[model samples]
Target chain A: MQQKQVLLLTKSIKEKAIKEFYSKERPTTLCIADLGCSSAELNTLGVVAELIETIENARQDLGNGSQEYQVYLNDLPGNDFNTIFRSIASFEDSLKKQIGSNNFGHCFVNGVPGSFYGRLFPTNHLHFVHSSYSLMWLSQVPIGIEDNKENIYIASTSPPNVTEAYYDQFEKDFTMFLSCRSKEVVPGGIMVLTILGRTSTEKYSKESSYEWDLLATVLNDMVLEGFIEEEKLHTFNIPQYTPSAEEIRFIMEKEGSFILSQVDVSEISWEANEHYYKNDLPKTAFTHYDFVKCMRSVAEPLLVNHFGESIIEELFKRYLETVQVAMTKEKNVFINVTVSLTRKG
Target chain B: MQQKQVLLLTKSIKEKAIKEFYSKERPTTLCIADLGCSSAELNTLGVVAELIETIENARQDLGNGSQEYQVYLNDLPGNDFNTIFRSIASFEDSLKKQIGSNNFGHCFVNGVPGSFYGRLFPTNHLHFVHSSYSLMWLSQVPIGIEDNKENIYIASTSPPNVTEAYYDQFEKDFTMFLSCRSKEVVPGGIMVLTILGRTSTEKYSKESSYEWDLLATVLNDMVLEGFIEEEKLHTFNIPQYTPSAEEIRFIMEKEGSFILSQVDVSEISWEANEHYYKNDLPKTAFTHYDFVKCMRSVAEPLLVNHFGESIIEELFKRYLETVQVAMTKEKNVFINVTVSLTRKG
Candidate 1:
């Protein structure tokens, strides 16, 4: 289980949001949900534990020890939500015993396993929302990215300004995101989103980003050597988005239903090294590492197509060399920015 | 000054010997001479040129009409007096004309210059030896490479290795190339040596190859912030050795006695295209615009001092971006190699 290093920059902004929620928009039963939650024992338990601590701390500080809260754990159907629900169940049981079940109530956690872009919770049923390292992924690639495919999941570099198709999809996904939140989140609910982004003014070219370039290079090597046909290349897409800070701010402010409270930016060093690949992360973030590991599955098909049976051995060698070189040379850093906003009551 | 292409790759092994002599041996001559001869341009003029044309037209009948040959223009100094003077000169230059009041019948002519690393002429006083692009510079680098004023020329990757130092020095200078040839040639003889070399090689470091790193990143802004200093760089060696082919084989076969042979090597390309700039090459040797203009000069100084002026403005900007992203990129072919020889005897 890899434990993600909490982004201190985003954490600071989140702290302010939590404060506003507890002070101004207090509810008898606060409904908090972290969307795109993957089922890792620690993520389910750790975040719940943190939420409990925050609520308790606020209650004790304000001399109002009678605040009730309900936390929700949600993710896509493919995510490990079952484990999350079980972990949440155990957590609630443990806390009910220690803190008087009646005085300090436990959260009624649920895993709404579906794409968060569309309607998930009933209208105006949510209070606080938090999403970390997610939301940037478009629901599906915009149309026309591939020669004949129906939907595009990844984008490739083409002639100048030819990514209009991907941008359109991103626009749809963002609009859906805003509308989805607008329906479920209470008028005064606060939402905090921390995702990847870029600062350069250059338009989004597939090869413009290091992550995209590395992936494309690897894939192209496979395609050129006949490991995988060109058709297979179009099947996959990085569901991530790299909105400039300005772009994100514009989207939220223009939506008009949400009032921007704060925006914080920082870099996340995620290179597989002593710090990242030691396999010492908390159980909560292990799912993220597992997702990264799944990428090897994608590379495997390409390798097998090119090198035949020798693909496995050759892949390991290439992977080792790549990891070594990447660890030493210009290690990867995930640029992160968090925006916190309150819905208009 | 004719432009050199890929012709040197086809030169015969015999001619290779003489050119080495004219460039490295520094022999003296009493008759004809070749100055600063280059392998690539050997066939651009003289006998080789005729040989190429003959080969090209071999399908038709051989040309008729023959004339006696007197002199052969070989190299600047020590050259192959045996072959250049005895055979190629007569066989190739079949046309001749009478030209003296004294009625001296000058059979095939011979002269080689530059550095006569081998013997050039006979024991007694004799005729001419020519050299072009052979011997006008140091044969090797100075003894203080490790002790250069800035300590920039450390032999090998670490401490200096004298053997490697010699190889390095040989690659750097072209003037100090006459000692042995000077002793072999007789008095009252002509010696022409054409050499190529630099003023110094101690200024650049290995990091120069990673230029894109320094130019396209924050390094540029850092320079603007007054972080880097400025300095000068100079090269004093020519990694090539041109010893008029004749001089070498002559020294090997005939202990000491040999005569002058006409020597000739082109020198025009040295100063051509002194001011041209292009982002991409046009499939030609002259396409290495950056190498001749900016790269060679800046490579050393920018790398050696860690604070040279190369960090200013665009250089730093480009360097940084290149470092952060471009340095990791790979290319298939990265180096160019060219060397040729000619027999002058």
Candidate 2:
């Protein structure tokens, strides 16, 4: 769903940049990098396939159909690279069937395991970079937010200091990210990113923080029932933040390594895929099960680390009930921010 | 021993090229690739360390002391990368002790698991490439040598067709090698290789083929004693060759992608390190045990694939006896050839 939205938002810019790269750079072998390319949804390669198709189309249109591609799938060191490698043979075969074996043979894919915050490729080697649904994650939870014992993330009830900590951390991390990428990307290289952001400039907006508020309520109930320690809840904070457009632009401009080519903002309903909302059926179709499942996959590591593995199922069960009740009262939506930038010479 | 000799032969050339690279390219991040870098000796990183030291010294001399390095250690996919990664921490620490921590932090080392017969990196990314004592092994043994049953490699006793087949295979493999590296290395990049070669123009010279002749004698004895089948021996030629320097020059010029910078040939006595010759001791010191052990490490896989596991110990015992007797009769030496080339624009 995130990929579909991101692709929809950046379709024109992506196509334009690919054509420009073919006509201007004229690189016989184009190198591309996909950062934070996790294999959970099995759609990372789909993104690479789309990128390759675009380049192939542009190359053919420009009378350079023989250009080769070297695609790198990058993720953290602990990601499931084994599964990715195991699936590569079939993936290549399918691509060959789609693009014809002669053209498909020009593409080579390899896994690069590392953090995106550091330099992973040779300088000025990459021509195009794509990242989606990954930059919102801070390297770690904002420092000094421990005193916000009742909340797992920035919330309306929290003091101003909590929000300030998160904003400062994002500024530091995003600046470092742009700085590293500036060195890796070649002159006139293009980078497209889809990130979680808030439409409102206000830090305490309910649309962005309410999901965490409901999750906090679920964990509070668990603590009251003696399912987990209150201290563990107090010590744990989610290593995620949704930035505002102003915040993102501020960092990009401050870093001054790239020129923003385009920025688009769109909203996704929290209950966008609920059966009741999709089919216009009765309210009985409304359930938080899907939401709980999706959020659990993202947050399980932190939950398991803090509360142990035994209580995960029960915790999420309570989370589903809490979210189901809160969803009827508030129609929360998440802001999706897509930005395209051209690397400076 | 091979590593030491290769490094000694290329020391002056490597140093000179590094200095020229610093003055000409002035790359802030130097990329170096070491192909056929197996971890069997646990000293592949030592080679990288030596390369880094040379580059660092050159950079400092050119007033570019802050330049960083990225070293790629490449080998077949079946290599023991776990051992290499396990030893990397200590390797980095030792490097830090030698060069200050600030300088050590500038170097990054990674394992690239793949064959050198194809592309393993981005085009024009590498500045300096080194390979040693590995190019002699063809991807597979030459076809049609199956009919030549008396020897396991090119030998004077073998049919003329057998020598032709081996030579044809080397030409194919070496041509593909140069073609691939030409695309990967940047214009003016330097590649230094130390390959096993023969000094004589004759394809079946005793200097290169006598080792296999003695091994064949050992295997024949095993067949006579009913320890192994004679038919298995006939089909098991080693996938290796020692090309003449002229043959190498011919292929390089034919490929026409690189200019020959330097070529040197040297010979090492077969018994150079044997205790008998080192100390002028009695015949009791005439042990082929070291030779047997070294060859077994290299040939065990092929031998086990042909002969059953049960006969390995007995086969090597006979091999030791055969080598000891041959050493008394005929002194043998191996010819080592080192060549340096510059990639053309």
- Summarize candidate 2's per-residue lDDT along B85-125 as a digit string, tens digits: 56666786788777663644356666666678877877777
Work out the TM-score per prediction. Answer: 0.43, 0.77
What is the alpha-carbon lDDT of model 2 when measured against the actual structure? 0.79
Off by over 4 Å in 1: A1-3, A7-9, A93-102, A147-157, A205-208, A234-236, A272-320, B1-345
Go through the candidates in order and give each one's C-alpha lDDT.
Answer: 0.46, 0.79
Best candidate (score: lDDT): 2
lDDT of 2 by residue, A1-345 (tens): 345556666677767776676678887678888889886867787777777777776666666647678777777766765566556557766776766536443566666666787777777778999888899999988988878897999987777899999898988889989999998899999898888888888887777787788889888888889887889889878888889877888899999999888888888877654543545665545786666677888889888988889999888888888888777776667788878889988
- Which is the leading candidate under DockQ? 2
State, as a TM-score between 0 and 1, how close model 1 is to the true structure: 0.43
| Model 1 per-residue lDDT at A70 | 50
Quality class of the docking in candidate 1, CAPRI style = incorrect
Candidate 1, residue A255: Cα displacement in angstroms equals 2.2
True contacts kept of each: 0.00, 0.10
